[model samples]
Target: MRILTKFMLGLMLVLAVACSRTPTRAPSAGPGANPQLGDSRPHSWTSGSPYGQAVHGIDISRWQGNIDWNRVRGSGISFAFIKSTEGGDHVDPNFRRYWYEAAQARIPRGAYHYYYFCRSGFEQAQWFIRSVPREVGSMPPVIDLEWTNSKTCPRRPSPAEVKREASVFMDIVGRHYGQRPIIYTTVDFYRDNRLGDMRAEFWLRSVADHPRVRYPGQRWAFWQYTGTGIVPGIQGDVDLNAFAGSRSDWVRWLNTRLTR
Candidate 1:
């Protein structure tokens, strides 16, 4: 409880700083990966330190700064999720380069399609499926559903609508990807869409709300606990995330599914 509270306090500071900071390094290059400033430690975490065993990966879109795959691999990066497309027609230009680069670098990678409430989820997912080919080694695709475009009233879809749209995308991508696609969401968006029952691997965002564990009583494979992270091989700054299980879990999961 104490640890969680401390993280929340840190979040309050991060949000304030992120407002003025230009989002030059995020998936979409705008509000999606805004850096949280003002925190005592710009890049810090309360992780229990997984003894170099757990899976370490990153989720990137166009706005997510410059990434050097070689440098990242040197630092023990095992996997990554690159944003491929958004809405039904807008595909990320950086994804094509990054996806192939990661694959060439011999890294386990996955592609994600951001769902736009105003567009068709199925179409967006299909677009991603088409854009990102089924490579020899590929992680399942992901659905990124978050409030967008500056929280505009008309632009923001209703909570109910978001849920329906998310389901549509999930189902479509799930069918095409051959596995359950992961769902990436923040606390606010997750609650608004009631995503707990969606039935897929969850990638929850929690930069500061650590010890407290915001997304309680649920199964999650990845927890993005920090956005104020500065990593080598990535330009400017980047978000940091960690897997929820031990090294054994990683080896087991990979051997079972990716060993084909």
Candidate 2:
């Protein structure tokens, strides 16, 4: 009877230990936990990581080449920024097709213009306005500013000159589209041109770290976290961006920000 009691006690103790042990839990498949967003060159983010944000998007141009918009939308892409015009006359070869396909897929998409330092801001804005239609329910226009090492036109204007041109571009485009233009810029361009001083929503490029770390004291609408992103429909690598808000916040932003 004593042996039986000892065995029972041991069994009880074993059961108790088992109960006390923490159960191995499956990883959460909640918002921001998307398996589709694979990066070719992934960054180990510490603080201010964009992965936690629920609203994610992509920016594409001709380089992406014949995208499957349906697959892209299904792969958890909430929005897109299609490259429209560059310089004073150059239009992205795939802009119209991408715009139509993305709309058909029900993805809220915007158009962005690449600012060329060689041309005046007015000329660039005019080119962009001419190329992209002022469609209702579309996302706002964007001005992409960056210093290039181009052999043709490698003019690095002063901060004052940069700001002046940027303002002109934004004002002209904003008036035409009836929505404020968002500035898309790199860390080097932002710093060199002192873009933080501008009163415009920024879509910043910071692949290694968070935009807050790269562009201190700057409020950003979108963060381009990875250029080598492997989206489902995109042929090779693509730029992945994260909106700076929750899902609900994203909805609210779109409602208020989209061009009328």
Candidate 3:
């Protein structure tokens, strides 16, 4: 009788330990679940991957070339950021076509400007405002900041100078569009400029791992996970991004974040 009692106690203890070690299963169709996610050159991420995010998107420039907006929308793309302007005078050749087609396809689209170190922020902001139209139901504009190896403009200003220029640019653009701008940046540029101190939503690029691993505690709204992405409408490899929320959360964000 005593042997039987000891065996039962040991079994119960073992069961308790097993239960403690087992992790609870997350909801299959809840927030952070994305069954439609795909990649052309997928990475083998061990942890902190953005593929689990529910909302996915893409960013495009003239390099993408003659996109079929309808096909892109059908491919589970929730949003898009089209490159509009770069430097002070240069405008993307395909911006107008992409913008119009994307709107016709009913995809939530926004414009982005590539920062030019040679020009003043005010000039760049005005250039962006001239190029991109402010329309209702459009996503907020984006300012992409990154280091360049341009022979014409090899200026890498101090962090203070970069922040000052960014502030000038964001202030002017935000006021003109009636919505705050999103800052898109790489890990090195973000770290060098200490962009975490800035008061704007960030779109971070981290292709190997997750943004958390690269940016480290920095809050981001969008994560660009892969550059060699295969979408239906785009001809060549495209940059793939994911929103940091669920489908419901995306709806809420669009409702509140879109230009009035």
* Model with the higher TM-score, candidate 1 or 2: 2
The parts of candidate 1 lying over 4 Å away from their true place are 1-53, 64-66, 150-154, 257-260
What pairs collide in candidate 2? none
For 1-260, candidate 1 gives per-residue lDDT tens digits of: 44334433443343344344543432222111222211224433345322222445677788875678877765656668888887777778798788767765656677877666667666776777778776534677778877776342236777777777777777876666677678888888887767787777888887655523677776778777566555557765565666776544654565444412
Each model's TM-score, in the order given?
A: 0.75, 0.87, 0.86
Which residue pairs clash within candidate 3? Answer: none
Q: Candidate 1: worst 10 consecutive residues by lDDT?
A: 29-38
Model 2: runs farther than 4 Å from truth?
1-32
Clashes (candidate 1): 7
lDDT scores for all predictions? Answer: 0.63, 0.83, 0.82
Which regions of candidate 3 are displaced past 4 Å?
1-37
- Superposed Cα deviation of residue 30, candidate 1 (Å): 28
Writing each residue's lDDT as its tens digit, candidate 2 over 1-260 gives: 44334433543453354345533442134323366767877778876677777768899999999899889977878889999998997999999999878776767889999888999999999899899988766889999999977787889989998899889999999999899899999999999888888989999999888887888999989999889888899999999998887655776687688777
Better of 1 and 3 by lDDT: 3
